[model samples]
Target: MIQAPGKLADATVPHIITELPGPKARAQIEFDKQWTSPSVPRAYPVVPVRGEGCTIEDIDGNLLLDFNAGIAVTSTGHCHPDVVRRIQDQAAQLIHYSADFYLPIYAETCAELARIAPMTEKCRVFLSNSGTEAVEGAIKLARFATKRPYLVAFLGAFHGRTYGSVSLTASKAKYHAGFGPMLPGIFHAPFGHVADLKWFDEVLFDRLVPADEVAAIIVEPIQGEGGYIVPEDGFMQGLRKICDKNGILLIADEVQAGAGRTGKMWSIQNWDVEPDILVTAKGIASGMPLSAFVARDSLMTKWGPGAHGTTYGGNPLACAASLETIKLLEGGLMDNARVRGEELMAGLRAVQAKFPSVIKDVRGIGLMIGVEFDSHERAAAVEWGCFQRGVLVLEAGHTVIRVSPPLVITEDEVVIGLKLFGEAVAEAATKV
Candidate 1:
């Protein structure tokens, strides 16, 4: 029988008792290949059968330390007791409800979002099922409120996969390869550079779309898929200024960096720049599927009845999970992220020092960290090395491995991850 995750977050160390993805997992993978769509990207062969805290048990009976946090979605760690309990209680009370009608939990969730809004003015929230829908809603609200046709997004930013959100995404060409006739009036500027905002005004505006015609300027305060790029304070401040100057709304895509993952309630809080609208998801509900796009009350009021509605946007179970998740975050998890992040970053830097040529850079804020290698090949090798060692991780950007673990990650867990990471890097150096 497969083992179960430990009671504590750091209970499991890197232990590979059998071949990676041993017999049972290999069979599952074989069947998955036949039944599942080929488009889904499978990072590694580890197939999880059970999870708790910060660990997962693969189908093959190997206990794996989960540093990826299910792609940084499990904020309070896998199946956090409080979040799970909330979800279970809510499910027993009310399983599903349409937001078209009044729902007590839905209103409560919105009120909570308003309480923690990063905007300067009072804000209202629009709940959704995923980050893509939140992005779509944010852009739609910006356009409806401003009555403008143009949008400005960063070159390396990833909004979502929906037509509207993907049109603003410029991270990978492949995202747009088969799709065509992209939404009109969308433009991209070099991200994380203050000077690019100036170039956007001088060049893009002078030659292409007029600045005044733009409805919103969307950006990721910390680029996730492109890389864990933490732009300087001046960069985000510049975006805010540019948006204000053009009478355009600033939309902060905080899907991957917000919800206290960056040691703050919102990722943009780290830059001290308030956005007109904010989109967040990943870690908002601990592990449940939920997302929100919050806008200034003034802008949100422009929409009347029938402007927007959702069927399952505010699932009662998910809302319950979110409320408890935010409680955990506000209570002390954010501080844990800050302290543990410092230790992890320092350890990663030491690893970089050991293999300077292979490792390029180590950067992030709080628990949202990334280790960039010199090449994609090297990054893949190191990623596989980490997986084999039993500490889970995922690659981002072209040559970067993201180190985003759960906010519940403890000091001892950080040390364990570091030790395994360093050994993986050492092994990867020789081969790649």
Candidate 2:
């Protein structure tokens, strides 16, 4: 093994060996199938045994540059030293407390999170185990704070898969199928339609639910599962204005787009809009299961004491991991995301220009990116092509090829991943 360096490395690129999901990986899959749930193996083959920087190694000893970042969860890369050390040190000391008891690390994490989130001075936080749980808490807080029934979300928005969040998520039907009677008073509207502003002012605001009774409007600054759809200019600001006009809270769901993934602390910052409640998870703790709902103190005061609570909400190990993760993001790693993302996007745009038929559209702000295709089949073909070439990627929305690599992804690795993706696109185009 190469001796570890204290600072960042100069040259960073993937080194591939055996084919992806090779013999050892296939054997592992065969064993996993014996007990693992079927729902867990839906998309993407299983290999990933180890990872560092932007590359993941399969059980077969194949190294593949990770572009999905565990669905945008590992913004600081896999098992970052700081995060690993924190988790290790904290785990050795104390790991669980059921959240019923107070813990210093939990309180410290909350304090630091409030410092970075918008409106920190007046915000209070509630911790949770996963992204969906945080969304549920945010919704509940909004409803409780306003004592109102109506809530609004946009089409193609994904909050979470849980009941309340899934109801707010209007992206796909599969998440809501057979789950009868979602949270009532939840309404859907077209996002990015600025021309409809006056209509909301003169009509829909009251016609929909009488602005007085509307509680909040939840939106992702950049849509994740619905495609890396960035909102139009002033769209978020306009929403903030409407919420202000209607006395409704504006909730920003940043589970997949926040924490330097977009080259900023929060994706909403790009639009210069502040949310009353900000929901975040996924990359917060590197790989730990941690999510949080932060809201203004006054707004959070609506709940007495027992309004929300979870068994594994604020485990010390997760908080320690998160503390280290956030520190790394605020350091040089985020700057790397900015530089590497520009290079990756430019390369993808070049690919788009070459094959407009296969590559419908390439859009994203920073590391979170998407390459849309004319058809789902074409998209799937591109994915398979990349897989065959020993790279990993994912799909979103109807026909979008998602390309979100870890923030730690180096320029050379990105070029390699892009080359593989380009080859896949070219092959897919010929197939059609």
How much lDDT does each candidate structure score? Answer: 0.88, 0.83
- Predicted candidate 1 versus true structure: per-residue lDDT over 1-432, tens digit per residue: 111334533355656778997989999999999999987878999899877777888887788888899998998888887788899889889999789989999999999988998977998999998999999999999999999989988888888899999899888888888899898889888888676677776888899888888899999999998888889769999888888888989999999999988899899999899999999898999878899999999999999988987899988988999999889999888998898889999999999999999999999999999999999999999899999889899998899999999888877779988999999999889987
Off by over 4 Å in 1: 1-11
Q: Please, what are the lDDT tens digits per residue for candidate 2 over residues 1-432?
A: 111322222234344465656778778788988988875635667578777766676777666677888899988888777778889899889989877778889899988888889774478888998999999999899988898888888889999888899899988887788997897888888776677556566666656668888889899999989988887888888999989887989999999999878888899999888899999999888879999999988888778878888899867988998898888888766777778889989999999999987788898988988999999999989888887777788989989988888888766677788888889999999996
| Model 1 TM-score, 2 decimals | 0.97
- Model 2 whole-model lDDT (C-alpha atoms): 0.83
Name the runs in model 2 displaced over 4 angstroms.
1-19, 196-203
